[model samples]
Target: MKRLLFLLKKEFRQIIRNPFMLRAIIGVPLLQMLILVPAVTFEIKRLDLAVADNDRSPDSRELISKLTGSLFFRSAAAPLNMADAEAMLFSGDADMVLVIPDDFSEGLAGITTPRLQVLVDAVNATQAMLGWSYLTSIVRDYNREVIMARGAATSAIPGISTSPRYWYNPTLNYKYFMLPGILVILIIAIGLMLAGLNLVKELETGTLEQINVTPVRRWELIVSKVIPFFIFGLLDLALGLGVGWIAFNIPFEGSLLLFFGCSAIFLLAVLGLALFLSTLASNRQQYLFVAFFFTMVFILMSGIFTPTESMPGWAQQFNWVNPVAYLMRINRMVMLKGAGFHDIARDVGMLTVLAIAFITLAIRAYRKRA
Candidate 1:
């Protein structure tokens, strides 16, 4: 216990004594959160729409007004013809073009279906799909209003109506969905860099040989080295959560102590992986390259930007081993869904298994020999 405590002191001293490392611990993640969180959103907003209205009737003008009034869409000048509308799409001036045929107003009065054509720029398929959905919803609402205004038989055919209640995030704010994921990324980054580089730095400076010659066993060194980084990981998590709550107004729906406890376990797994990586590299540069490669794989496969279910079967299977994925999943579930420990027992178990496996692997990988 005495030896481990002394080693922990040494590790903290090294981190505190170095200005660059201190800034990295504090500043890097802070800057990344401020810059990236707002930019990372899936919600489609402010799509430019061009109208080619051949009807030029009051009904047609009403439809155009509806489209322009929507928060997702903005009205650009009406194009002259299909050719001009095509040019607008080609020139990237319009994301969607709505064409109301000449008989649109007459068709409504005559009890006939009006012909309306929509040309959507599908360069970004997801954005295009969402934009089309918005347009269709507006048109459907206008159709309902028209039927009501004409005093038509409302109960002729009652279509199926759905009342969707979005829990936790009623407004569907993208930041609410993304902030927890970003916090996970930041902690993983800091834990990996610190643990991976710490041993290599000692090895490069010839102090590792001196420490190895002492009475410290391999497990003692590993535990001592990991303790400080584990604390750091907790500190990083606290900082991120504070910022997320204050700046982005992220909700804390679950128990804070439970969240922090799970985060600590997740950090143990991440820090252990970093220690294992450290055992493979002799210097900081080599560790960096190796760390970066694993970092990219971990982040990409962790379902931060994409859904795990959307990945290939093999990739989804691989996510079982990814601590970051589990942590990200659990954090969001807890925060957004207000899920309890019983709800996330399976994931929590997986993280515990990973934490033990990684720490064991890191212990085996570490060598006292030069």
Candidate 2:
């Protein structure tokens, strides 16, 4: 126990001694949570729409009115010809162009499908899908209203109606879906980077070698190193979550204890990876490179910005090894999905496996070094 205390004391001293490194470890994450929480969004709103209303009929004019009335889309420009519409898209002036072809109303009159062409810029695929879907839905609704008012049920105009009930986010607010994932990412980035840098600093200043002569047991040394990072991670997690609830007004419907419990497991894996990297690196510069490399890979594959299921099979398999992947799912499930213990069991189990694996590898590395 005395040896454990010594190791713990030594680790804390090492952290306090390095000013820039310590600041970076704690400060960057806080700043990131502040900036990125608003930037990452799933909701597509106020999308710029250009229209090519060639029909020029009452029905087409009504269609334009519906487009302008949508909460998602705003008419950015007056109706243009097809050439000008395509030109506007080419010039990045619009996201979508609604081309009501000249024969559209005529087709409705001549007992045919009245085609409404939607020209979409798929560069931002998610937004494009949302915009087009909203447009289509509005047009469909308008068509039905026109048909019923005009008694066109006898006109035999076929239409499809839809009733959608959003599960968690009723208004499809981007903040609701985004805050949890951003918080998860901030915690991981902050925790792992800090832990790795802290561990590697001791090696750089020859502090680790000096301590090796002492009779400190391996587990004591490991736990001592992890405890500070664990606490720091816990604090960052708290601040991010608090901000999400207070500043952003995101929902906290699920168990807070469950969220923290999962965070604890992820922190173990991060600190373990840090310790393992410290064993491999002899100086601060090498540690930075190694730590940054892993951090980049971890963040990119975390599914905070993208879905893991959308990845190819090989990449999905790769994500299975990432601790943040599990954390990402767990965060969304808890905060957005309002999922209970039963729903997140798989995520918890995966994080457990990753924590054990990283810690085991770290222990092996530490033993080899000692």
Candidates' TM-scores? 0.91, 0.83
lDDT of 1: 0.89
Residue by residue across 175-254, what tens digits does model 2's lDDT show?
Answer: 78777777777766766666776667766677777767777666677778788888878888887787777777887778
- lDDT values of the candidates? 0.89, 0.79
- The reply for model 1, stretches above 4 Å from the true place, is 111-113, 213-215
Stretches of candidate 2 exceeding 4 Å from the true structure:
13-30, 55-59, 78-81, 102-115, 154-162, 213-218, 336-343, 367-370
lDDT of 2: 0.79
What does the lDDT read for residue 293 in candidate 2?
86
**Clash list (residue pairs), candidate 2:** none
